[model samples]
Target: MSETSWITTPVTADILRGALELERTEHGVLPHRLPAWARAQSPDGQLAMAEAQPSGVRLVFRTRATAVELDTLRTRPAYPGIPPRADGVYDLLVDGRLFGRATGTGGNVLVLDTAAGTAETRPGPVGTVRFGGLPARVKDVEIWLPYNEITELVALRSNAPVESVPPGDRRVWVHHGSSISHGSNAASATTTWPALAASLGGAELVNLGLGGSALLDQFTARTIRGTAADLISLELGINLVNSDVMRLRAFTPAVHGFLDTIREGHPTTPLLVVSPLLCPIHEDTPGPGAADLSTGTLQFRATGDPAERAAGKLTLRVIRAELARIVEQRAADDPNLHHLDGRVLYGDADFAELPLPDGLHPDAATHERIGERFAKLAFGAGGPFAPR
Candidate 1:
């Protein structure tokens, strides 16, 4: 904790990775998951706020320090008439392995009240998260911020000087999906399913999983198209179904267009089209998903009529069937394209083991299951992500 040997370095966006944008603030840098152009297209304040909050973003550098400290300003949620949400967790990784974890004691906390359906920002004292004791050899360190909180990077101090770490030889996997993929209810930033799968598959990650905003927007596709990635995977269908954004008539073409946009930049990149996982609530039923609060807890439920599927209303089952057919038809011309039924990742069997606690989002245990399953199926031998 002594400052005699410590070096106080500015935690600028230069050392940040996995973020699309770093918005400079008077206090410090705010890592944004989405680019500015994408933000400009949407006027919704909620989506705007979520995109700016760092989820997959992390601080990566080479250092010999056994002790490290980072000051941050975090905003958390407080659901009215229900238990408050858990504070964000910070994870520290060294040499590509998890080394330490810490939670902030104080920070600028924002109370997002669900009953009022509004967010209120409250200014608070900045908090310091510190870690001490490590092997003294030079190694890479990553400080992963929480997935569901707005965090501002204030400062980084270490007992020894640090330098930028060179990129690894592994391929980078860029995945796009909805809140589930955005690490909703995930235990920590690095433990999210995508992160776990990346670690297991020996790949770098750039997660574009925007919570509640993965509406197959053209801007997101453009963002992905602009990124340099060795592989690409689109976890489609869930967001489409739940949002009730489009019918089967529009869905097929939308999927094709989205893929077409990505392929414009990465023609031969392995593209895996993932369908929706089994959620009995929306398996056969159409959705305009609704939140149930009769029990004083937030539980999601499908509000759409099941009979509408005959009229092209999309449901999980309907979308899965359509996506499978689309992939099969497209793969004839594009051999690298593939489709995966998300049920294999979290099917009826998984539900029996660990059910979605919120009736929509997966719990922490389910995240682990999905991550491990994805690594085996997506990156294993004969898999699209497998090393050639």
Candidate 2:
């Protein structure tokens, strides 16, 4: 498809309109905001875009560094002239073609002027600019970011006309997760494990893999609960582990709450909750938390201190076990709920083969491995995510 041909808004615009909800959540909206162009082509554009009106499916991509040092290095290796800024450069594609791109002048700096409510771009090491006003005309789109320059993609949006779409058997898969699921360190949006998995499984997708933003909040879960999807997966626990954001006592209930909210509307839909893959530091460790004395950022740290490690602080192994237990207990009453070990997607053995560059998030090869495993274990015939 031509990059510009992606403007098939008339067809996709309506499909998006039909799924909008009036209720709101921390993340806001049932359908969320249908891009103006996507809404303009529909019959109920006014309602679709009006107050409390549901909009389009939202795909958030977030990042949370397993190693605090990595978090400290965000957007570092500052491009020539740009004063290292968190924002990075990227390209967007739909299907197999280029759709749009975030422009970056190699030697430019981006200044975030919150007071002015606008960012100023000037010559520096690297510059970042967003590309919006997308067509929202198709069920699938691809996002490409400079792998060497940009470490991750934050989110994705679907503006397809959900309201007027011709009747068909197409089922949309709404996925939400952190940087790993968000296409971090991947060559392009299409190459992201989730995107690849969705394509390989033959399901349309709304990517909500927000980099550093998948904290399993009511808002995020509520957002997913209100949206429509045939399949939904929440790759929780990893971010929690890496961020050391909550204690063990709080982790279990948070997972339960997040899932409970999603279950409200998708009562019988296959819902998979995945625990974090193996990351040695948090695999069996605990935490009281460690402050990066250098930056005063309290990153998730494992107290190599044996006494502290034994205290049952929040750890990946602990979180994973707790999640499994919760799912097992809940599944007795909720048959649609399922649990999968993130290791099945990227295990310790797999890590030996393709160690994460930053010792936290998986590298490109690992992403490919994850995509394949997810496709087979989840999308294969008889699997929970398989089409009915």
Best by TM-score: 1
Which segments of candidate 2 are over 4 A away from where they belong?
1-168, 287-306, 309-312
The whole-model lDDT of each prediction reads 0.86, 0.56
**What's the CA RMSD of model 1 in angstroms?**
1.7
Candidate 1: regions farther than 4 A off = 1-4, 113-117
Cand. 2 Cα-lDDT: 0.56
- lDDT per residue as tens, model 2, 128-160: 334445543433433343322322112122222
lDDT at 255, model 2? 83
TM-score of each: 0.95, 0.63
Model 2: per-residue Cα lDDT at residue 260: 84
**Model 1 score (lDDT):** 0.86
